[model samples]
Target: MQGVTVVDHPLVQHKLTIMRSKDTSTASFRRLLREISLLLCYEVTRNLELTSKVIQTPMQEMEAPTLEGKKLVFASVLRAGNGLLDGMLDLVPAARVAHVGLYRDHDTLEAVEYFFKAPSDLENRLVIVVDPMLATANSAVAAVEKLKSRGATNLRFVCLLAAPEGVERFTKAHPDVPVFTASIDERLNEQGYIVPGLGDAGDRMYGTK
Candidate 1:
């Protein structure tokens, strides 16, 4: 609640509604995800500091504003997170990218990491961790933990949808990381899925089971 932001722009809401429909095709769902991710990126990076730079225009040289500090690092939490990553890259082409591959143990519902690779200078950059659904907060929390351990300090979490339980758990686990999402659903189902969610984001987006 305190550190969460819902991107309620009309375009974001409209695309989310389209994504939620069970009838939407896999291709359509992926397209909408990319589109909405751009909007989400806008909100997540809203407060990035800017510095003035003197540059030459077609007609004259003048001072212009540009992002301050090192290029941001966008850390994607495996397959599903890549859906959001593709779109975020569209908005911030210069930003660095990281991948954290984690999967939930079926029985235990705990996150397990298989792969992790990020920029060496994470200490000097802002890191934005992304996953489509923050259902249990297991993967999201684990991913952020890994990033922090690797020297990432300034961090944010962005997702397409979040459950109240996941948000509470995530915020409690990482109080310093702000969260950005399109919607916060009511609750998680017994299977750790968000009700009224867009189904399994990975499945719908990639035609997986």
Candidate 2:
């Protein structure tokens, strides 16, 4: 609640509702995630700093506002995060891309990283880490930690859905990083799944389940 910002735009809400439905087809759900992610990108990047640069617009040379500093980085938390990645890239086409592969260790309920690759200039740019679900916060927290280990300082987290428990834990672990989500669901179920969440995002999107 403290650092979390919900993107409650009408289009986002509409798309999310479609995604949450059990009757939705895999192709339809994937399409909706891509569409909703574009809206979330708008909210998450709303405050990016702008600078003026002289440019000729047709007849006159005038200053034009453009994003300042290095290009942003979209660090997707693998599999499901990739669903948001395509849409986010649609908005910031010049932004760099990174992937962090992590999975929850069922017994220990801890995040285990299998792969990580990022741009070399992560320290100089804003990094927005994305995942579709933040149920237990294990994977999200670990992914952010791995990014920081690679010199990513200016970071933010984005998700399609999040549980209150996950949000609290994520904010407490990294208060400096802000979070953006389309919705905050009631709570997580006993199996560490977000209640009423769009099922396993990866499975649903790719039809694995």
Candidate 3:
């Protein structure tokens, strides 16, 4: 994919396999998600701009590399996104947070936004949108569109799994924003679910239907 990067790290793939199993319990699934997100977070922020800053270490004063410009913003797409959000925050505690609430309309497989909140200084920061699955790309696209409307120019999308259909639609819709995922599954089922994907991420995480 042109604008997509599939994180094929060994640990990421290993954890994803466990998460994809139907027998995995909610507690275990959530735990593995948080753990994997930490690894994914490492890859997503790999290219962040770095600037040297003077700092006093235990040994002596030295210039150390630190993230440049404004702090990062992780814009989570509602409930499922929070699974990725928790671990991302664990890695970047000082990073700001944003929430874009959206749900899939089963019949149309379209996103319907119910709530949205974010920092006012969106244009100054790099926003990384997080969601566990990019099945239809409806929610991911809508969330990014909403953020851009609020002045977020630099943005990236991160998910645990993505469908080829979803990736194509998402990239075509917002070619400027890059995508990071653990895997691009075979295809999306008729109900807009990623085939052979870990079933409904939100449901599995929360033990809901």
Candidate 4:
């Protein structure tokens, strides 16, 4: 997390600009999030190990590369994380999925986990915990802790956006997990929302607000 992967690629930045505007429609925002998620997924999975194999191409036989193992798991940090899931799944369609839900205590800013589900053998799998935003690191950090306690070892975190404070807190808490985010926004507000964030991800994505 110290070297949190922040994607500043032009396309991602452009779509993020669209997301930030107050007038962006739900359909447009959803499409943009999916498109950007696909791009971001490409970056996040770049280092996955590959094994060589003989295969038949359209023209002729050739050596091909495939994933080294079948130990991948995709864990979402709840409602908003669902938006990022489809895109990541497009890249890793076969990965097993898990979900964790955490809500904040308005006064204390602490995370309260109300729901959690995951693969039983999490310790041996390559877990990718994804969420749309990393704001204050409360839910983010808590989710990782829960995953670890449940036996997740090889873990990677993916997000659409992040705040410096959140990233710092997360890395300090779990240095082993590398983080991937499309953009790192400015500081967090008193309520822990990333400044200039795309409002509430869950609210915006589902038209709850």
Candidate 5:
């Protein structure tokens, strides 16, 4: 659909497998996050506007296409999203980064915001709200809502993996924004975890819980 993209890249699948394994070491998990983020970046920027520019090459002058419009803002959804940010930055080094922290309450399953910071001119730039695991969609939806409230008009959501339930909820909540993920698994478990999905991305990345 227009609002969702399930990336079929082989490398994405390879790294995702590593990330999903329960035995994957913390350092490896961190590395996989970075690699997957870079892969996601390629798909995310595929439709970016491009304009021709004249530039002098080593041999001669040539007209080359360059990205157009305001630079993108990589807005990481706190802890887990931070792991995705560094790799995306490698693809777009000059891009600015914003941080939004939201934690799902274990009891209520509600998204709680502890920190939020973004570019003041977000309305003119494309914003990518990133997190590795989009499970129930509460944190992700809340993050996007908060960004819209802060004058963000152009927006895209990126995550390494997603649950089908999360995808349905997120798309229904904000159909106008596109979401890019490496994989979408089965339904969420009773504890709101993605069934057979990577266990607690936040914990895997940080070695906590």
Candidate 6:
């Protein structure tokens, strides 16, 4: 857990419990994800560099702290990542967006990318990659690698749940990038699913499979 930070906020834990329930409806699950993501977003960006800017207040002129440098980029790992993306955008309305489309090849549980689109100025921005689950870390690793290839030096990975195996692999693969998650589950099942997890996140979020 060297480079990982678990949000563990009361609101985040409460909503995650509801999301983990099998009986939760798709609409409810999606809603909870968006809500929890806002809290996670708060924690993830907590250390963002701040610079004071002079602004005029009704009473008088004052210097207010504002985010420094270019706007941050939220690079969503398509589909499930969008669940977190929606709420993150609500919190950081000025942030830019990026999408990296990848899917697991069932046979190998490896990521296969089909599409990618990101801002032209990646090196100048901080990119946070969002994906709901890090069961195998295959997709997460691939997505981060793709972004690094495109000049994203300052990057982070955010997910709802992560398995110990996935976390170890991810950290070793990209130790420079920090990870944020709601929980690190017990372990991953044989089929590459997080044991006792909320089930397939994308499936539960979209009512598929």
Per-residue error for 177 in candidate 2, Å, reads 0.7
Q: What does the lDDT read for residue 58 in candidate 5?
A: 95
TM-score versus the correct structure, for each prediction: 0.98, 0.98, 0.99, 0.94, 0.97, 0.99
lDDT of 6 by residue, 150-201 (tens): 9999999999999999999999999999999999999999999998899999
- The lDDT of each candidate is 0.95, 0.94, 0.97, 0.88, 0.92, 0.96
After superposing candidate 2, which stretches have Cα over 4 Å from the reference? none
The candidate that wins on lDDT is 3
The digit string of per-residue lDDT tens for model 4 on 98-162 reads 99988878899898999998877887789989899898888889999999989888999989889
lDDT, candidate 5, 144-183, per-residue tens: 9999999998899999888888998999999988999998
Q: What lDDT is obtained when candidate 3 is compared to the true structure?
A: 0.97
The Cα error of candidate 1 at residue 97, in Å, is 0.6
Model 2, range 1-209, lDDT digits (tens) per residue? 89999989988998899889999999999999999889999999999999999999899999999999999999999889999999999998999999999988878778889999999979999999999999999999999999999999999999999999999999999999999999999999888999988799999999996
Worst 10 residues of 1 by lDDT: 103-112
Pairs with steric clashes in candidate 4: 123-151
lDDT of 2: 0.94
**Could you tell me how far off, in angstroms, the CA of residue 98 lies in candidate 1 after the best superposition?**
0.5
Error of 6 at 141 (Å): 0.4
Residue lDDT tens for model 3, 1-209? 99999999999999999999999999999999999999999999999999999999999999999889999999999999999999999999999999999999999989999999999889999999999999889999999999999999999999999999999999999999999999999999889999899999999999999
Q: Candidate 2 clashing pairs?
A: none
Deviating ranges (above 4 Å) for candidate 6: none
lDDT-based ranking? 3, 6, 1, 2, 5, 4
The better candidate by TM-score, 5 or 6, is: 6
The clash count of every prediction, one per candidate, is: 0, 0, 0, 1, 0, 0
